[model samples]
Target: MDAYKLMTIAAIGFFVFALDKNQKKFPAPIILIAAGMFLAVFPYFSSMELTKEFIFHWILPALLFTSAYQFPQDQLKRKAAIIVTLGTVCIAITAVMLGFALYAAGQLLVGVSLAGAMLISSLLIPTDPVTVVSILTQGNDKHHLAETIEGESLLNDGTSVVIFSLFSGYYFGSQSLHIGTFILDFFYTALGGAIVGLLISWFVAKGIHKITFHVYQVWLTILLAYGSFYIGEALGVSGVIATVVSGLLLAKELTNKEEEEEKELRRDLKNFWGIMEPFLLSIVFVFIGIESIDFIQMDGLLFVIIGFLLSVIVRGIVLLATIKSVKPWRKSYTNGDITLVTWGGIKGTMSLALLLSITGQSGGSDDGLLSWAFMMIMLSLIVQSLTFYPLKEKLGD
Candidate 1:
């Protein structure tokens, strides 16, 4: 697409977002997605494809960085155990359980392969940090819950990607899982990404400290955010984790700056990103909406519905079990907390991106997988986003 057309689409998305904000009755993402779907049928947008590379490389990194940058470091530390366990361990468990369940159902109904089902399961395991954090932090006073959710969302992407890659290889008959090898690969990817991110951010921070120009500092910070991701990917590590780690490290450094000029630079950078967050999200959600039109008429809607229902059940059961096992340290959580967390596991851009990746590799022959993934995501966003706030209020009271 041409520059003018790209700008036009972005402008339309922003306009929808503005309208949604003004009404304050529904979430902006839902509105943007609906508008994208409405506009996608037109000739002008029919050719505008939402590619996996475009989303995974160009859009996701920035969104992940922005969300992680703003996350409260102290709160994250306080709830580290909960966040890590939910993000990594619970996600793994859910993926395995959901994978087998879907595989059995597919065999009995539509005959999807075990590997294909597992691949789909892995892709949908990670909750979208962008959507969850956006909803959880909006006019909600439950800081601990919000922080736990945000932190988990940020970290879970890496876990999901690692799992997805393993299953993808298995699907292609390129790789097989050995427990020790899998553990080693997971740590190497995740930890290596974190190390790369920290080192890059440290160097960038040092450079910023010496630079006097506020404009240059702001621009450099943006570069560093993307730079960290690219560097991690170049090293064959988890770029998503790298971006998150870099953003968090940089955010910590900027927040701790006592120098007046550095503080001014930090303020300018934050102001710039504040506008960027919504702009990027509008484009992403709209793209999801547009891409979803193709899958709407997919075969085996019943299979997708069954998978969606199973996902919720599995998530709830896992949360209940995990919460019971790992006692909270800072505060006690009630049944309502478990309910909110279970519902708040809303899937968004990341899930779609992973699905697109699989479809691209498999020549799009995996019957009903794409449709199932899309419907599950839509169900999560519509049901969870609408009810989370009210549920939180009721549970709190």
Candidate 2:
């Protein structure tokens, strides 16, 4: 099928799913994903193809920006301690643990080179904000808890992307990284994206302040989000960070403006993103399911299972080490929250994007590994997305 036509069908399918008021009973993402898989199995859909550019340029920025903008900045500030610790420190711990585990496991089980396995491990570690945050925040009325989860998801994505890029560079790309250079390397990438996002957000807000029309102003933000991401990426900075920072900054600035015109624009933008959020999320998972149809193979099943186990073990260790500081980490949240959060770290689009970005040496070693990576990611998303809420309810005692 032609790409345009297939996308039209996807849009129709998503609309049907999105219109369901009982969306809480069934995740729109998982449903659309299942639809895509069903379509893929049909012989008539043999021509479908998933484009990497479509994901990076279109789907990712929209999803990230919407997630970031919808995040409650004030709530995030209120939970600053938990957010900062988990976002920065805990995320780094999880990444390192997972990378080393993959290195050791690959050598023992797959005979893969240590560096290559580490690269793949880095790619797999970052939890997709789209999947994880959506599940965690669905119906929970605890604003502080919700903010902590959302804020952690927002900031950790950038950290994970930066680390993933660094390892990818060291192992597969030309840029060499030594242990001593790790601090400087991380700072440059992350700080570069943050700075770019902040500046652009300020400029865009100022520009929109002059525009009294609400529709155009909202559209301007959409442009700015994509623009900041692409520009930051062009500078070899973290585009994900740039996109997210730009969103948070815009959300903060717009939330505070007292003027009637500004308030109206903010409302319009909020409503617009609210509609787009589920729509885009559904489309993303659909793309994943359709792509999986082409990539999933039986021979790689064992490796996929191993990768999933590695993901869980590393996350478990990180949570155990980091859960000490959360005020109500134990008391307010049950043993279930701790376990669910640890196991609920679902890898999705960001991981796939990292893998897709691999080219030449950065990618050569992972040729046979891509199928396994893709399968593990699909499994992560399905297992966690489906189980997170039920587990939360079952374990909330």
Winning model by TM-score:
1
Expressed as tens digits, the lDDT of each residue in 289-337 for candidate 1 is 7787887755777787787777878888888888887565324666777
- Each prediction's TM-score versus the true structure: 0.94, 0.90
For candidate 2, give the lDDT of residue 347: 81
Q: lDDT of model 1 at residue 235?
A: 99
C-alpha local distance difference test of each model: 0.79, 0.74
What local lDDT does model 1 show for residue 364? 64
TM-score (C-alpha) between model 1 and the true structure: 0.94
